[model samples]
Target: MTAADGSRLYGSDASTADQREALLSGEVPVAVYGLGKMGLPLAAVYADVTGDVVGADVDEGVVEAVNAGECHVESEPGLSELVERTVAAGAFEATADPRAAAERAAIHVVIVPTPITDEKEADLSALESVARDVGAELDTGDAVFVECTVPPRTCADLLEPMLAEEAGHDAFGLAFCPERTASGRALADIRGAYPKVVGGVDDESTRVAELVYGELTDNDVLAVGDATTAECVKVFEGLYRDVNIALANELATFADEIGVDVNEAIETANTQPFCDLHDPGPGVGGHCIPYYPYFVINGFETEAPLLRTAREVNDSMPAFTVNTLAREVRAEGGDLADATVAILGLTYRPGVEETRATPAGPIAEELAAAGAEVVAVDPLLDDADEFVAEMIPQRALYDPDRDLDAVVLVTPHEAFDDIEWERFDPLVVVDGRQYLDLSDTDHRVYTVGSGVTSAGRAESAEPHRDANLAAEVER
Candidate 1:
């Protein structure tokens, strides 16, 4: 960009003072593409920080909902009210035309999903598609920020060239600022919590990204070496969790073998500062952990044997859970093929409605394939159309005369607490995530990660648990 253009736009002068004044005066307009779960909260935060913001998405329903001041996104705290207030104040608006929104806005942010293909390759199609639209409306010194979690080198090696080709101008600034927030606390994370990591294709792009985020977040903006490093930050975070959880799950398998309580050991071990372990469960789910490993596994030529092994360990959890279920059913003098099973919790996480890559789907499918009748229940999920299991509401789940051959606690939402678990007589129970205390129930229960068996609950090898109980009783 020429000196005159630098003086006119944020790319040229990304100083905090200049950007702050520009945002307040409505001179530097902001456009956020993708208005889904994370996108809407981010757009709302932008509106709260800046005076004017446009939210763009291909989904017409989302566009209409935002335009009508109704939050289509579900279960997000304070998001509906934030959207209503922002729309009411005219600081935020939703649009279907990305090109139009991009043209009018000086800061164009992309928060689209980067799903992995069936072959486990990173699917940048959505990100590429949005970049093309953003490029179409780009002008000299216009800033484009990618907030999608992507494989390293995607921002500098892929997006920069792609945007340039589409825009016919290499002058448009590009930055990679990975979205670090989860679905439940997106607004809070975006507003503060973790410091935002920003890296750009060039020095100018880096400066512009830092300036814009400095105004949007109350937290400090950490400028990394380049866009690839920023990409690495997000992917590494997910990768670490995936491997850590895999380790825990692997250890959980030893409970039955070693005849000891693994969770009790883990709980005691975690008291020390160095032993930071992820919880073991039916499986690791969600859009992030399960998919991010594939980013490295398939993106480049280098082999990720450890990552591949971790994926295998996590992927096997569903079947392992089913195996435990089958044993319990057989112990009760019945085969799994002839028994009825109830799979509880469909969402990957509790209190959130997101179902992307949730392990509950696989657990339900496996049970059905094993010839057992499966009924799935979750307070957050009313529709289990994606799976073969019969989806029932919480009320129907707790029928007084209900009897199932087996029950597998998959996601374990808090709503399950309302159910009188003692009301049902069961011979088989599989507690994923170790959410149940089988010692109190008559059924032969198997708690995942606790090393407990269907015959009896496992005992801890260490005296830490006993010490804690004694300490608490004395107090």
Candidate 2:
């Protein structure tokens, strides 16, 4: 894959014709660093598209898994087959050594994690480590693209100068094209459900990126003015959700007092063009939505009162959910201190194995702290020891002889459809997703953001009800 000068034929300065031929003919080596959930699918897609790709990661386990033609990220449709085909065909390989991958590939893609620190600062350690390694073996005219979501100005200000200082000689491409994909739908999203956003440090860098992703993706490639703008584009997308979800959660509390069904109302109101409100749940979970607000809240000097407040509102959801459950349970003569509470779902998103920043963790902690024996049910997780909660198989949750108190449906995973609420017949069933139809059942049920039903109020000793909820329900 080298020219007469022993350099990559597809370096930044090669003529358009030569670069195009090399990329299309599988002569130019393409490397995707960070063989993770997002990175693996991206690497597979790149290999399937270019017929030559390498995957690099710090974890030797991931490297071994990939090289053996085995996939570590499950539930992503078509990923296993893609990985098998790519590995067997010799178009893809995984390595623990970043320098080896960097030295071989002309097009380097970095998709490492950019976790936020406890102080809310962007922890660019992984990104920087990969950058340093890639720079040490830097070649002229190579292109390095970062798909990791980062704060604004990270690509140009921090990454560009760092790579330049390391390279010292030949030029390479540095761009931030944030990986905009969810866990289950990564392959489809990357192949082309959405257009690719590419913003490079310079005009030439942008042009080179446009050429690469344009050939790789079925969708059009958008070239932004610079890298920071591209970073803002991704951050803005996440910030919008954080704020919208906070608004929904806030309205949910008000709905209980006013006797309104926030979920029903949200669905009805969303029929219009400009009204797309997110669902109100126990809380916003997952790595992206909960933390992206910090980019503005902590990174910038601007007064972001609303952003801060929204985070507070979302963060309070787990405890709020617990309080709601506790109130109903106490009204039924069951104390959370001795109650056997079942947390229905553990993952942040349904059908996905990721539990990063999931609300279930906090909810379980609060319940256990209150002296409740919490048994979490999620088919995706073998054991939830990380959350310090006991794991119970979903089918076993329906054992006729088992005794339980309250049931909190957190994630609304599809497997919960078959649960017989009466089997665990004792206290209240709180639906955080608001989609469960427990109204027909004999058990008292409370849907978050909705007023307690007559069925729930009937469980009380008298006609007495929660004062705030009394106005919304009839006698």
Candidate 2 per-residue lDDT, tens place, 1-475, comes to 3312323532445687777667777877888999989999999999988788889998999999999999999899999999999999988999999988988888899999888998988888999999888888778877889998998999887888888788886378788888889999999999888899999888877887887788777898988989888999999999999999999988887665566677889889999999999999998888788888887789888889999989888988888788778777877878888888888888899999888888888888788888887776777775435443342322233344567887888998888888766665655778899868877666667787875764535442222245643432221
Candidate 1's displacement at residue 395, Å, is 13
lDDT of 1 by residue, 359-419 (tens): 8877877787788877777787664454423422222344546677788898878888776
Q: Give each prediction's root-mean-square deviation over alpha carbons.
A: 6.9, 4.0
Q: After superposition, how far is residue 413 of candidate 2 from its true place, in Å?
A: 1.0
Displacement of residue 54 (Cα, Å) in model 1 is 0.8
How do all models score by TM-score? Answer: 0.91, 0.92
The clash count for each model shown is: 0, 1
Q: Give RMSD (Å) of candidate 1 vs. truth.
A: 6.9
Model 2's C-alpha root-mean-square deviation from the true structure amounts to 4.0
Show pairs that collide, candidate 1. none
Instruction: Show where candidate 1 strays beyond 4 Å.
Output: 1-15, 383-398, 453-475
